[model samples]
Target: MKLLIVGATGTLGRQIARHALDKGYNVRCLVRNARKASFLKEWGAELVIGNLCKPETLLPALEGMEAIIDAASARATDAIKQVDWEGKVNLIQAAQKTGVNRYIFFSILNAEKHTDVPLMEIKHCTELFLAESGLNYTILRPSGFMQGLISQYAVPILDNQAVWITGASSAIAYMDTQDMAKFAIRALEVPETKNQTYPVVGTKAWTAEEIIQLCEKLSDKTAKISRIPLGLLRFLRGFTHFFQWTYNISERLAFAEVLASGKALTAPMEQVYEIFGLDSKETTTLESYLKEYFSRILKKLKELDYEKSKSKKKKKTPFKSSV
Candidate 1:
């Protein structure tokens, strides 16, 4: 099957492209920078230089493709409207014009319920557009990426920095990007997954306190936990309107409260596995993912320490008595 992967340079999109190639599908990628995407050619992907923000570029990329997987996301608030909303609409139109058979999209879990949030609102609008575009579609609503949590909470603990947990008792599930990519491929291949939506969740759920424990056990590093009340999270989210921020700190804090309330957690979906015939892959645990990442962090720290020690010795040598 010939497949075109939009946003092929992104974290999840690249993985999907690689997995599709590994599965022996002919892969094409819509890319903005041919140089950055040169490596993808080595991985057996045909790179079509184009930006999703420009509709004229999408037609050439969408041509002669059986399916399109949209994993694109905006980096900033303004880009969200242009890229996520407008860009996806452009792709849907191009796909319809080209008679593309299937359209797969990765949207965040609970996006339909969070229309007030800017990012979610964009995704919600895009989902509506895709459904009405007269193309066969499969939508995967994945939980937060496991990497996001590990980078934020696990890395800080490994580096001996304080990580603040808003609700100690809140439990949330996170999926590895690799797993999400694998499932996305299945959705493309499996007949049962067509024209359906699935909540692609992690194998297990962890509470905020349990998250710290897992990291502490795996890295052998103590994590300083600062617990904040839920009320404070609401107060903090109110501050997002004062000025623009990149990390979406306000939405993050607000979502933290949702995780704490257990509202965002995905319940077990036996039907998803049964219908898709998804085999049990290796479990993705925080301890397992952080082990190697912590080693790298420790290695970098040691390198910096060594450099500082060498500089100190050079200084202590007294400059050869100013000779």
Candidate 2:
């Protein structure tokens, strides 16, 4: 089947495109920056230049596509109205115009539960539009990404600093983007998956302290943790909105607020596992994720240190004038 991956420039979208191609599906990526998509080209994905915020540019990308994976997201709050909300509405219209089969949308878990949150509210709006569009659609609400959490704390832990969180003792559900991409392809492969809304998550839920322990074990270093009280987080939620004209509530801050309220619970994994048998590798555990995350960071730091030492040596020998 021919598939179009929107937001193909993103990590999740790129993974879906690559996995689809590997499965022998005709994959086309709707991308804004063709220069950055050279890697996609090398992987045998057809790149179509278009912007989701602009409807006219979407026509070419939507034409002759069997399905669309809606993976687009705005980088900041300013573009949320345009990209996440309007962009998706535009894409759905174009897909209808082109007579597409299935529309697979990626939304975050707890989006429905936390409608007051700015990003979640926009995502909920898009989800509703897609459902009422009368098209064969599958909406995936995956929990927090493992990569996102790891990247956020890796530097702080490496620097021997506290990884401050607002979640306190609450548990968080972490899902790997690779697993999300795999399930998206499965939805395309299975006809019964159409018109369904799934809450995707990792195999287990973990508390902040549990995750810190895993990180400590992997890095062989003590990790300081500072968790903000839930009461303060609640106040910040309202306080940030009051001062919206001055300071923008960041994604991290927004997520911390959500977690502190104990909203980030693991999805119903048994139901998902019943349909698609669990592959241990894809449903990664917190321990495994931290180990790999730390290993990669250590390797990169070593490479940087090596480069610096080489530069220092070159500078030391450069005092002799070239004659």
Name the best candidate (by TM-score).
2
Global lDDT of each candidate: 0.80, 0.80
lDDT of 2 at 84: 83
- The TM-score, computed over Cα atoms with residue i paired to residue i, of candidate 2 is 0.87
Q: Model 1, 127-219: lDDT tens per residue? A: 888888889999998767787876668778876888887764546677778888988888887888888888888877777777788778767
lDDT of residue 72 for candidate 1: 80
lDDT of 2 at 192: 73
**Error in Å for residue 182 of model 1:** 1.3
The stretch of ten residues in a row with the least summed lDDT in candidate 1 is 246-255
Per-residue lDDT tens digits for candidate 2, residues 20-113, read 8999999999888889998998999999999988899998898889999888888755556678888889999999898999999999887877
Error of 2 at 113 (Å): 1.9
